[model samples]
Target: MFPNNLAFISSNQLHLVQSSLLSMLKGALHYTIPLTIITFCIGLVLALATALARISGIKILEWIARIYVSAIRGTPLLVQLFIIFYGLPSVHITIGSFPAAIIGFSLNVGAYASEIIRAAILSIPKGQWEAAYSIGMNYSQALRRIVLPQAVRVSVPPLSNTFISLVKDTSLASLILVADLFRKAQEIASTTYQFMLLYVEAAFLYWVICLILSIIQQKLEGRFDKYISK
Candidate 1:
């Protein structure tokens, strides 16, 4: 009976790990990918606007950009998430947890990305703007043709870092029943009552995903460097 008992325990552990991994992958598809794409797109737009505003001739626009970046960078992302998810409901304009999480992450990403964008834009020589004007090119035209392409290449490394951070940040969604990878692990752990083993497996999966992302980031940087170095 001793080998039979051991076999039962081993099979049960394997089942828990498999279920947890499957559920985590399933939840990641539904919650994580959509959240990352939505948040990153929204943030990219906001960052562009904020960066433009900061570089505008208007003082008020610059001040607004400054305040936005300051506030977002100064505050913790977790606190911002809680306020959007929990506190906002008190005002009667309730958002679902998923939407709230997206909004919070987008705002945070925008604030950080704005600085990178502005720096990238500024890195171009002032003579480029003068030359664009010499050819009768307006600000927008010059920016589109001459500035943004270069700035985008320069910003890729930072942007990759932001995306990687967003992937990890998705774990925070568990607090709101968003059923992300972490939440899947939690569910499996409760059902199997093998918290440590299941959680360790989940962590391993998370690490693997992050490692793949890191490899992609490195390749991107290498490509960008090849173009920029020339």
Candidate 2:
């Protein structure tokens, strides 16, 4: 009788795990993945603009970019999220949870990735710029046609790492009721009182997603390597 009861309990637990997995996956698919993609794309644009501004030889633009990067790097991401999601309403500017999360994440990414991009652009030799100029290329034309393309190859690996980190960072959205993967896990755990199991499962899902991203990153790096001189 005890063995039969054990089997019954095991079956119920398995069913619970399956249901929880499905629910969390739905959250990931519907929210987490989309959020990462959207925020990263927006962030890349911001990063490029900020990096260009810093290197543009204009004192005002450089100062603005410097201050922006410094502010973001000095603060914790959690604080940034709270300020956007919770504090914004005090100024009568209310943002919904998902959009707020996106704004916070994109700005954070922009600040950090701008440094990476700026470094990559600088790493290109001065001769490359001179060569472009010799070919009658203006500064903008040289950057667009020559410098930025090479910088992209150097920047890919670090940018991929940033993207992977962003995937995990999306869990922060749960704090603001974004109903992402971690939020789904919290919901399930609260009802079943299975916090350990649910949290582990949620972490496993995040690991899988990051693992896949790492593989893609490797593939991208390999593709970019073809252009590199031996």
Best by TM-score: 2
Q: Which ten residues in a row have the lowest lDDT in candidate 2?
A: 1-10
Model 1 Cα displacement at 76 (Å)?
1.3
Model 1, residue 28: distance off in Å is: 0.9
Task: Report residue 24 deviation for candidate 2 (angstroms).
Answer: 0.5
> Candidate 1, residues 1-230: lDDT per residue as tens digits?
56875556577687767766778888778888678879988999999999999999899999999999999999988888888888888987788889988999999999999999999999988888889999999999999998889899989988988888888887887887688788888887887788888778877877888799899999989998898889
lDDT of 2 by residue, 50-81 (tens): 99999999999999999999999999999999
lDDT of each: 0.87, 0.95
Error (Å) of candidate 1 at residue 23 is 0.5
TM-score of 1: 0.90
The collision pairs in model 1 are none
RMSD of each: 3.3, 2.8
* Total clashes in model 2, counting residue pairs 3 or more apart in sequence or in different chains: 0
User: How far out, in Å, is residue 22 in model 2?
Assistant: 1.1
Q: Which candidate is the best by lDDT?
A: 2
lDDT of 2: 0.95
Cα RMSD of predicted structure 2: 2.8
